[model samples]
Target: IKDFLIKNKITFIEDETNNNEKFTRNRIRKNIIPVLNASIAGGLGKFKRFFENTDSVLMLFDFLIEDRLNIMKSKNPIILDISKILYYNNKLRKNLLYYILSKNLFVDSSLIESIDRVISSKRPNIIFKEKGMIIEKSYNDLKIEREAGDEFDKEDFLKPGMETLFNGYTLKITKTVFIESLLKKKNVFVFPLSAGRRFKIRTLQTSDSFVPFGMNKEKKVSRFLMDNKISLSERRRVPLILNEKDEILAVGSLRRTGLYRMKKQKGCLCIYVGKN
Candidate 1:
């Protein structure tokens, strides 16, 4: 390219740093390239061919990994069965982990090794936290999630028939005379009519404690979240439904407080949780 440009008498600006030996890249280009070419026949051509082949292999590897991830995603969007990673060779396994995690955070070899160790342990409810990201393994399932950070502190109040958005979830409270027996607890919270029609929607707190729905004994909110396999950072984002007294009525789309359990009631208060 340089010879062609000179032969045509074309003028082009050049960066002066290319000739500076103080930089490692400049030293490699000015010093190492000539030495390698002089030491072996067709050395430059060989090196170029090697790099081209390596890039092709890497592209194919990435495609295969992506195909596997897409199949896993089709089964479940949140939790992934990562046990299959154990079947891959160490280098390939680490590279695949790096590829998957790099989508969420800046990952290095050391971080990948640490996560690999955690996965190999096969212990139930193992969690590895680093740089605002949590890599959790619950038996065979894996969860990679970012820490809620300051976003968890954002709170709002919910009223009957009024929809409010909080942390990517849409919540609406309503009083209903008819109780739906098949309500999915993961998306809706049903409480007794006495629990109040209006509630505050906020993330979990350190001091929060309540008797989770279907339980008699009171438990710390932190412990309850951990029991559900929620990581420390993720627990901060789990919405808690509270009444006028600031008492927790439910863990929001999770389990409701036993205090609000409807027992032969004519009507019930329902809070529907949906993703925006």
Candidate 2:
């Protein structure tokens, strides 16, 4: 087949169906017997003609299925939440479930049953479908937030010239000591120390309340960005500071409440500011 395609300058995709016993069992259980019955009733002949007329459509479906399967394998194993079954019609839901089973994707049958029960009782939830996956909405008020930053590389939270005060003694910048200091603060400033690299800063003038990590968050910057789908380049910038207590004093828009005061007390204030 490969040689024929190459010699004729023809492009064709080959689907190799496994002939192993395990796959045979699956075919028998899911498709073969049903198809045989339909064939006796002339349904299979109609289906064959339909597929012949829709060759391009079938090709597209095959490509989509292959792409989705590749993605599923590359990522973690398929996982589904049962909460979404209510959103799809019965036929679609069953087809989706059958696809997962045919692909050998792991799913909690109990969860699917539970979801059906909930829907039967007049409750419906969000639905998500991807690859051999299906999930139901589990939480009603869940909020999702996103941030743009360099992938965490070597924890560059503390850089040169940042000061830290420990037990009344001011300590100079050292990698070990810097990391130790950050462990104490609930919120710490993080910035890449390499020169010319830009660190994102949020300012009062341009920032909005959207808390990415707190219980009930507030941040206007995030809200504005989301409302307009703002790109990262247009976001506001802020200052990055390291404190005498080995903490991130201020992220950019807001000062760590006592960071400036501690810097003055130590008389060894060294600031390393990055541009982005």
Candidate 3:
């Protein structure tokens, strides 16, 4: 019959009401139904037990569907609330928020707007709420600024006693006897030049090591530059050499580590800068 219906494309709906009578009679009148009726003679007890079990199963199914629907609708399953003042007044808060959002948190548009409003408010003592967190800015916590006044001139030591090799360039006589000897030679040379925009060399020496700011440990001149923040422009203009042990001996605009240490110890072969 099922095959025949399918072949004919017959659409039919089963009438559960017809089966309901048979099902109830089997449990109540006959008292021969399974588990719910096996030990109970009265129909009420068996029916009640059957209804309870059925309800429990249906309840579980409903709960699962509801949970799935909720998950689908929620932007952030684990909602977070931050105080408006805290969010706007502290850079750390902004960084933390960016980190959390980057981690795929379900952040809402309101939360973002609230953060912006707090940040842009004219008064420092602004307060607002976002998500479940309350943010309040404390006026007292505002960063204090120092007044800029008399500016002391930085003594330029690379001026006197140095011969001009290139335009705006000079080679000062270093206290290092070996460097002085090298400088005196036609091939060996020194050019007082700036390092990259962010750095300046206070000393130069025959042997030095630099950790390259972000790298693990001090590396050779070439390795440090390759690993660190050296720009192509600076690298092209800068001069660096390695010692026999493959250690970085000198880097333009950055004091050689060995030379800096030696200068601190008041050792030989140290150079000090004086005003031009």
Candidate 4:
């Protein structure tokens, strides 16, 4: 290539860094390539050919990846289904993530461990950090998003049918005919927001305890959250619906206080929490 450039009168400046022995490529060019010229099996032409083949192979892998994968961006943390992610083996999984995240960001090795743990255990809401971004595993869904730069609403207390935008989701309470079916609306509970300061929704405290709806024993908020597999990062954001007397009503996406459950009551207000 150097001879060809000279013959064609194509002017080019040399990067003097190539002569620096401290750099790997510079040492390779100065020592290894010169030694290869005296050997029968090793030479610059052979090494260049090998790299050409490697480039071709990488191009083919790129095409295969484009065909098998697609990312869903409509969700807050863009979601990548586990079926697509796990389709590749360990090596290809690394390649796919590198491609998806691009070269600018650096993904930690722990990400592969996170994926393997989720796949093997089949646990939901598994959270891990990748390049300062949060990657969440919820069953078959893999959610990837950057860390929130701003704080989530510190406190949100809303009436039934009212919605509050918090963190990355919109939490809305609605009065409905048990959206999850009357028999299965486990987390739904009635809490009158008209009580004003008497009723509030805030983050759970360490000492918080409540008899989850239908259960006789009161459980500590921390124990309940841990048993639910809620990640530490998310537990901090979990809202606790409370009464003026500091009674726990609901623990957001977990269980709620039984004080307001419909049970066999004929005509009582029921609240359903929906997030999207």
Candidate 5:
């Protein structure tokens, strides 16, 4: 390449660091590799061929892994169906695990091994946390979640406007005349304005209980969440809307109090939970 460049009058600047013996690459090229080439039969050529073959195998492995991942497609938490990969050989399984986890965490061989063990165990619910990331196995689904930036209890006053809450959710509190419009939306909850605009948003509590929108009997907030299939990590981030007396008016985007549901046309407050 250098001879061809010189013959063609193609000017190029060389990095002097390439020749510096203090660097590991330079030391290997200057000292160790020449000795190996002289003592062994086609040592450098054999090493080059080994790497080329390894690269080709890896390319094929990547293609196969990508096809499998597309079939197991899921949302934000990167859920994988255990059944899909349960029958795979060890090498392919580990490769797929590394691919899925490498996006958010530094996936080493040991980490991959640990994940493999979890899969083999077949525990209904198993959680492994490392470096601010959580990998949870629940029945057939393996979920990967990043720990929230601020996992502490997030609370705010629900005023008559828009505000941000836990996990970048938009909490919009406004008075709307069209009761039918707000009724159609799942995240939007309506309450009588005469009930007084004194709602506040806070994290869940163990003893929290509320009468769900359609139910006459009161239910435990924790039980409600479990029934609704809310994960343990997600329960912490769910905002509980309350009045001045600390009565639970709503449980995040899940449920609201039936005691407060109003059908009045004129004056009603709309509390909308929206994603950014």
Candidate 6:
């Protein structure tokens, strides 16, 4: 390209700043690239060759993202299953994390450590607090959000077949054909038959007691969350899903109130959880 330009007498301007070593890119090019070029065979060519294959890599990346988006049953916060992300290697995890926080002014690499810790642990709602940023695992979905100017206090009504976003989660309540296998407290449950017809999603309540499936016992919501490693600050913000009769069905992605056990069922209610 430069030879063609010179032969055609095409005038071009050089960026003066490109020559200044004060900039990191210029410093690296002048100091590091020359050393690599001299010490290693095909050092310069290797860099160029990698980029030549970038198109194919980028296409694969796009396909993975598209596939995840397609399987999403609900939106708004666009929650994704944690297992789907953790399934990838570290490099892929970093890329996915960057993609998740792409909307922020800048994505900090330090977040990777906190994110990895949260994903691996049995804990829930452990916030990775940064400047104007709050990242936490809501159930299986990695949730990210900017610190709000005001308190996050809001409520919404959830009906079967409808999905909505609440307190940094994309809540999806879907009714599907239920098949009872005698397994208890599964994420997918029978609606109306299991969770009832309507749900009211709001902030956590002091009186809440969530029953673990088939255990037939009630535990304090705060204690349950604390035992799950939910921080005091996050526990207050955690939303609770209440049935029409004001019974706790779920403590907002942390756990479901699994009181009723199904022996045989016709349909199921699926609550797909994810981060915004």
lDDT of 1 by residue, 41-128 (tens): 5667776564576544455444445553341342212345566666555776687787655533445688788878877785888886
Off by over 4 Å in 5: 1-150
What are the per-residue Cα lDDT tens digits for candidate 4 across 117-218? 564455666887654467777877777666564565456455543445455444555433322354455545554333223345677677888888778888
Q: What ordering of candidates by lDDT runs from best to worst? A: 5, 1, 6, 4, 3, 2
What's each prediction's TM-score? 0.43, 0.19, 0.21, 0.38, 0.44, 0.42
Q: For model 3, how does the per-residue alpha-carbon lDDT over 123-233 read when each residue is reduced to its tens digit?
A: 767655444345454452321111222332111222212221111222233322233343344333232222211112222232445544334567656556656587754
- Order of candidates by TM-score, top first? 5, 1, 6, 4, 3, 2
> Which candidate would rank higher by lDDT, 2 or 6?
6
Q: How does model 4 score by TM-score? A: 0.38
Best by lDDT: 5
Worst 10 residues of 3 by lDDT: 152-161
Which residue pairs show backbone clashes in model 6? 77-276, 79-274, 79-275, 178-267, 189-269
For all predictions, the C-alpha RMSD in Å is 19.0, 21.2, 27.3, 20.5, 18.6, 16.7
**What's each prediction's clash count?**
0, 18, 11, 0, 0, 5
Relative to the unseen true structure, what is the C-alpha lDDT of residue 109 in candidate 6, on a scale of 0 to 100? 77
Model 4, C-alpha of 67: deviation from truth (Å): 45
lDDT per residue as tens, model 5, 120-215: 884789998865558788998888765565655466665554344455566767765655667888798888876446667788788999999889
Give the best candidate by TM-score.
5
Candidate 6 worst ten-residue window by lDDT: 67-76
Which is the winner by lDDT between candidate 1 and candidate 3?
A: 1
**Which pairs of residues have clashing backbones in candidate 1?**
none
